[model samples]
Target: MRLDKFLKVSRIIKRRALAKEVADQGRILINDRVAKSSTDVRVNDKIEIKFGNKTLIVRVERLMDTTKRDDAELMYSIIEEKYERDFKNE
Candidate 1:
C-alpha cells in the first residue's frame, strides 16, 4: 500500500490529502529514512510521523483496502510517542 493511502486507511492522519502534504514536506519517514507520499508500505515496516510538537512511531502490522473505524487501530501498533517541549515560549 502507498504511504499516504495507508495513513488514511489506518486513520493516522485523518485525511489522504493531509497525509500526502505531510509526506511531501518530509515529515514522514519509513525505516528511519525520509519517505515520499507514494512510498510503498510493507508489513513490519516502521513509520515515524513528525507533526506539530509530537513524534509518533508505529509499526505496520497489516494492510487493507478499506477498514472500519474500529479496525483501524489494528493496522499499526504504536511504538513510541514523544512530545517535544517548546521552551522558547517560556
Candidate 2:
C-alpha cells in the first residue's frame, strides 16, 4: 500500500490529506529514510512520523485494503515514542 493511504486507512493520521501533507513535508520516514506521499509501503517495514516535537516509530504488521476501527491497531506495532523532552536529548 501507499504510505499515505496506509496511514489514512489505519487511522494513524486521521485524514488522507493530512497524511499526504506530512509525508510531502518530509515528516514521514520509511525504513529510516524520508518518503514521499506516494512511497510504497510493505509489511515489516519501519515507519517514523514526526509531529511537532513528538516522534512515533512503528513497524508495519499487516496491510489491508479495508479495516474496522477496532482492527486498525493490529496493523502496526508501536516500536518507540519520544516526547518533547526526548526529542531535545536526541
Candidate 3:
C-alpha cells in the first residue's frame, strides 16, 4: 500500500490528502529515511512522523485497502511517542 493510503486506512493521519501533504513536506520517515506519499509500505516497516514538537513512531503490522474505525489501530503498533520539548528539559 502507498504510504498516504496506509496512513489514512490505519487512521494514523485521519485523511489521505493531509498525509500526502505531510509526506511531501518531509515530515515522514520510513526505516529512518525520508519517504514520499507514493512510497511503498510493507509489514514490519518503521514509520516515524514528526508532528510539531511531538514525534510518533510506529511499525506497520498489517495493510488493508479499507478498515473500520475500531479496527484501524490494529494496522500499526506504536513503538514510541516523544515530545521534543519534554526531552529538552533532561
Q: TM-scores for all candidates?
A: 0.98, 0.92, 0.93
Cα displacement (Å) at residue 45, model 1: 0.4
How does candidate 1 fare on TM-score? 0.98
Model 3 C-alpha lDDT versus the unseen true structure: 0.97
Ranking under TM-score, best-scoring first? 1, 3, 2
Tens-digit lDDT string for candidate 2 (24-47): 999999998999999999999999
Pick the winner on lDDT between candidates 1 and 2: 1
Candidate 2 at residue 52, lDDT? 90
Clashes of each: 0, 0, 0
C-alpha-based local distance difference test score of model 2 = 0.94
lDDT of 3 by residue, 1-90 (tens): 999999999999998999999999999999999999999999999999999999999999999999999999999999999987766668
Task: Compare the candidates by lDDT and give the number of the best one.
Answer: 1
lDDT of 1: 0.98
The candidate with the higher lDDT, 2 or 3, is 3
- Which candidate has the top score in TM-score? 1
**lDDT tens digits by residue: candidate 1, 3-90:** 9999999999999999999999999999999999999999999999999999999999999999999999999999999999999999
